[model samples]
Target: MSLLQDLFTRPRRNEQMGSSNENRSVLVVGLGRFGTAAARTLGELGEDVLAVDKDPMIIARWAGKVPVMEADLSDPLAVEQINASNFDAALVAIGDSVEASILTTGNLLDAGIPDVWAKSISHQHTRILQRIGASHVFRPETDGGKRVGHLLASRYLDYIEIEGPYSVVKVLTPPAVCGQTIAEADVHGRYGVSVIGVKNPGEEFQYGSNDIVMRHNGEIIILGSQKQIDKFIES
Candidate 1:
């Protein structure tokens, strides 16, 4: 039997392979930087991952971290070798070539992979992947754009998009705002945002206390709309 067939048909003892372990299988097609990160993260999270790449060199880099395979992902026959349905999700992370990305995405969807996520370079590419039944199309550059925005703004130390139009951001308390308690800061009242947590230098995050004074010595994590965050930063 082929490697793919062996992967699927091989029997496992239920007691030896707990139900949680059985449920965490994922297939990641393409081993570019984005793909490699996804595969490694999933493996770290205790998932059984089959990470594929067309380039042997890329596959070699992550061999021990995740189960790596070299395959021509654009070919439908090659895709069919795997029992695609066995995976809880599949990620098509081929970023460079639009054609290769689309073809691999189509093959995975056609082979009945339930959840297929494709990386897209543009809106048009996203639409094509979506039309081919990709469950999700992620623009990796969106985060890069957010990071750039933060860098330009200068007030924020870091920011992450949480959902539509909202983010979790970190910033230092300005000298103007130091010595006041969180309640006095009235972050939500004054800025239309909420302070979620605070972290001092070399310390873990803790829930913001109304009584704890801001010393301008640590970072504050806030959750709010981007507009609200910008307003807070400007103020």
Candidate 2:
């Protein structure tokens, strides 16, 4: 039997296998940096991941780490042989070639995979992928650049953008809020930002509460709209 056949027919590491509806069984195409990272992260999170790539060296390198197979996903036959429809989601992370990425994505969709996510390197690629029925198209380089720009331009130690204009930020507790309890500081009322968590030096993070005292040099996780967060950091 082929690798795809063996992977589909054999019992998974978890005895429950793909039978458990709570978890997802994902088919990851391509073995580039983004694909590898996604497969590893999904496996760590208890998701069933079957990663495929055309490179034999790449397959061997990730053998023990993630369930992987050697196959050129640009070919429709490869996708069909794997029973692509059985997967809850398919991520096409072929970054090098726009043609291969598009072909792989189309093949997955042709196989009836409902959620086919693809990685795109440019706006035109993104539009093409979307027009061809890709459920989602993500530009990792663009997103990462934005995140890095935000970090570099602000006092935030870490910044994460959520839906819309909201963001979550980790910042050093400023002098204005130091020596004051969360309730006394009135962070939410004064700055329109909510202190969701706090971490002191060399200590684990604790959920924010009314009684938690803020201290200089400590770190705080705040959530608010982008404008509110920028103002809070400036204050």
Against the true structure, candidate 2 reaches a TM-score of 0.77
Candidate number with greatest lDDT: 2
**Candidate 1 collision pairs:** none
lDDT of 1 by residue, 145-185 (tens): 86887767767888787758888888886565577778898
- lDDT assessment of candidate 1: 0.79
Q: Which candidate tops TM-score?
A: 2
Alpha-carbon lDDT, every model:
0.79, 0.87
Candidate 1 TM-score, C-alpha based:
0.75
Local accuracy of candidate 2 as per-residue lDDT tens digits, 130-218: 99999988899998999999999889899888878899999998888888899998989999999999997777888999899888789
Question: What's the CA RMSD of model 1 in angstroms?
Answer: 4.3
Task: Report the number of backbone clashes for model 2.
Answer: 0
- The reply for model 1, stretches above 4 Å from the true place, is 1-23, 55-65, 112-114, 131-135, 175-184, 201-203, 208-214
